[model samples]
Target: MTQPPPPPNQPPGPPPGGFGAPQDPPPGGFGAPTPPPQQPPAQPPYGYPQQPQQPQYGYPQQEQPQQYGGYPAQPQQEQPPQYGYPNQPQQPVQPPYGYPTQPQYPQVPHQPVPGAPGGGRKLSAQLQIVIAAVVAVALLIGGGLWYANSGGGDEEPNAKGSSGAATGGGEDGGAGGLGGGGKEKVPADTKAKLAFQLPVPTVPDVTDVSGSWITDKAYVKTGVNSVVGYDLDKGSALWTLPLTGQVCGASRHMTADFKVPILFEATKRVAPRYFQPCTEVGLLDLTTGKLVWQTSITGGTAGDKKVSFSEVTLHGQTVAAGGLDGGAAFDLANGNPRWKPQANAGDCEDLGYGGGEGGLVAVRKCGSYDDPTVTVQNLDPLTGRPVSQYKMPPGVDFAAVVSTKPLVVAADVNDAADDGSGVSDFFSIDEKTGKLKAKITADSKRYAPRCRSTRVEGCTQVLVGNGRLYLPTEEHDGSTGEYGDETNEIVAFDLANGRMVPEKTDAGDRYTLIPLRMDGGNLIAYKWPPYDKGGQVVSIDGGTMKSTLLMENPSDKTTRTAETSFSSIGAEFRYGGGRLFIADTLISKTKASTSLYDKKYLAVAFSTAG
Candidate 1:
């Protein structure tokens, strides 16, 4: 079936003044009247990829640009093959991947510099301004996207019994699945003993176990329609606020911090699909379990029929949310409408978060008749005005943004004919100008509808931190379906000039080190211990790639391969407030088959004090 054409009078140009420029307010004051729904080009169902389509936005194709001196500079090195490159021939008589390289930098005796930390002179006003200016321009020009649509990519499961790394977690009913009445003390030899454990209604295993440093509290949105706050030190419930409707979305998306507000969706519609229910979003204070504010959402709110919210973030001082129909942002202090985007008079769907500094970035489908393109708009997070607009690469599908500061965009270049080279690539774009700077390509086969049946986990994964990009590769022969003696390693790339940071063969030698999240001074990584049974929490020095084992999880390792070989990388553990909450489970098994419950999750508290 042909896609209906866009409505008449909808020119493919910016509204009056460009983004951030003052313009006569539209009829509603905050936005133009929501344009009538236009027919968007046919799209792959929410979870699938499609063959090359007509360029929407009719954006002209441009060649990827070389890195400029303005960007951070790093030693130039050969780009490594993406993790899990497909059709890789068996190695013969060659150095193995991730071999160590001779030290490139001269090691000099440590010498204290003037105006350094503790007793070094502070930067001059001019130098500070210059540094700030560089950051502002980088934020505005934005880097390319990072981490392609993770939603569409299935997380490959670890060996049977190893549920997943102890990073991401979800709510589960208070059932002590361990043997005995579950009063067994955690092994004393464990590097970090359990500090506390609290139970709540079961949530999906993928839900994020979010914690707040400001309150020293861990939060879990239970399935029983409540957000429970627990004292991180004592594991006692400080407060429990009854929530409206189902908890807004997947637990993993719940973000909380002292600086940023927490946004969640509640639907009054018990059966949401048939009729548009009363969908509401609430911003809550992270320190106190109080409702900062609440408001009803328009449309299903950026997500498809089943899911309501695609993105909810606190950018600068604004809270932005996107839905299937469109997106809106409001001032953080008072929930006044900052701005809401007007959908083009064509069939367009809202893509979730893009990159911008002190602004919210959004993408919308706006394909021309023959070319498919997406309009990338950077909105003034404060006023909802378009700061700038650019187009995604032609022929590339939707770009899912992972970072906004050193903007990284992730997109998949499909192999229309299945020639076996479709790649899920990561790109950095100039936020101000929306130009592609760097591209990191990975194997798309790792993102098949079923990732692990034929491939390893983290093949389609990419992480950014400390001015470097982290890529995960299979450490063992994935064909064996066992990781008892094998391990994985993270390959780092300097983003400034897109050069490989030679891997340290000695670091993380016993396990696969997957950079999971960045918190405070540490790049929290999961040490997937051999045998897919136990796991370790390692703090990786972002600049040096040094590893420090923080704690070892005592989660039981069962040997049961459940229905699907797909699991989230962080489903077994959660980190917050310098603490690691490790849940004991049969790591090699699926959540449904695991013997662990949310009540049995244990916390290992590290010093929050410097």
Candidate 2:
């Protein structure tokens, strides 16, 4: 049978909600008045299983109705002006104590004195001296107040003083120190400084450039039909490996030695047949900048057609590729066939596989096309056999594997999530027994983890490590009370019982913190840049939940603009060895109307080392 045509690619557009856009604060708004703090609600134990009140296993009904998820219900009131923009209707109020106040002067109408020569009366020298002294005193007081309130006369807030850092270690496999186990080196100073930036390569049209990785010696990134390794500190190209066709899929995880699996087309894209089947699989060695091996397989009823794949992953010594053509596995070292697709009972098909340090898990589909049953299976890496499997609840036609080891899967059950994010619930299962351990309902409007609806491993902003699931809460009003200034925080839920952990790491005012990946037991996170600030990278200790500032990008106008060019939704972020690399997954041709200020970047790097 001939393989199906590839899916059409959507044109890229600006990210929604005006994220990273600057807005003026409302007049006289220094910050919103701080509200009295309330005691936090009691948290359930990690191991105690709590039944959800709602009928669905993953979506629990909340006691209070909220305008958005994870936020408290508010009394009906007029909608506030958009963040970063001024509100004209708001009346000016008296300034707070210690704030500079305009000196008040009596508004007495000027009257010509009978003995005066002009329209205004003249004052004696003594009276003039008194007026000068009062004016001078007011200026002195106002200047002092302004200096104190403006961050001690500094333009930027000091990173060290503004944020708290984790010291020593905590229980439950706490991330001991920066670059845990000395596998990655920590800079003497964690304040991030600009290292270098790579200009976006000129593409004839819109192109896909989706892969990136970090190593001790280089930062590797995929370009237009090529992969380039750059010096970790200098941003200069160390090596470049060109390919015949465009890269279609790349594994998120790499082998211990830095070899990665990637899927590409058999030939370069040409007219009429713009997209070729992504059939070729290859292992790329980052250290040597070479393709160690490349191979393709034949499948279908006749066993003579080349199998096409939409995704690929590596687990131990096996590299697995899967798609509508079914799934196949090969030896990672020699590209030898390990297992080929076979007819399954009940018309079941292996859609894709998720592989990592933990193990390899496959998302299997069964039943008719209209009504499908999806199952998560823990497969033996060497021999393609399921050791254990957990059947998903009915109506879950698709599932994204968040993690393979602890077996965390995300799904949109019965079209309830509604949000395009493709997630409404998370299931934690016991891999050994294929039993459901816990189910946590995530409200689509409240949480911000995103996954591709059809891809098994295409998940981002959600991380599973140290027995917990970490996700970012939707951006909300910051306490500073400045209109248009929004922020968010990362909260963790216990994997054992689906109960939320009490501790959370705030993104601070105007910054949005997103989980990048795990570093040992620590969570590496990227702080999305606000209009006036540069992006930041920090390490959040898994045990204590304190954040140690890792890399702080430059806040200058040009640097800030460049750093934020990559949208958070589709960009790839990698942090290690005291550096942060941000790269765009797709690049399109610049339109004639595009302004010079609207510069595009292929990748940007920042480091804390000199």
Best by TM-score: 2
Off by over 4 Å in 2: 1-186, 301-303, 590-594
What is the C-alpha lDDT profile of model 1 across 90-158, one tens digit per residue? 112223434322211111223445768776556665665666556434422222111111111123212
Winning model by lDDT: 2
| TM values, all candidates | 0.57, 0.71
Candidate 1 is scored at a TM of: 0.57
For 419-537, candidate 2 gives per-residue lDDT tens digits of 78888878887777565555776776667899888789999999988777888877877877687678887876656545454456788889998998887777888999789888888
The 10 consecutive residues of candidate 1 with the worst lDDT sum are 166-175
Q: How much does each candidate deviate from the true structure in C-alpha RMSD?
A: 20.0, 18.7
| Whole-model Cα lDDT of every candidate shown, in order | 0.40, 0.67
How much is 313 displaced in model 1, in angstroms?
0.9
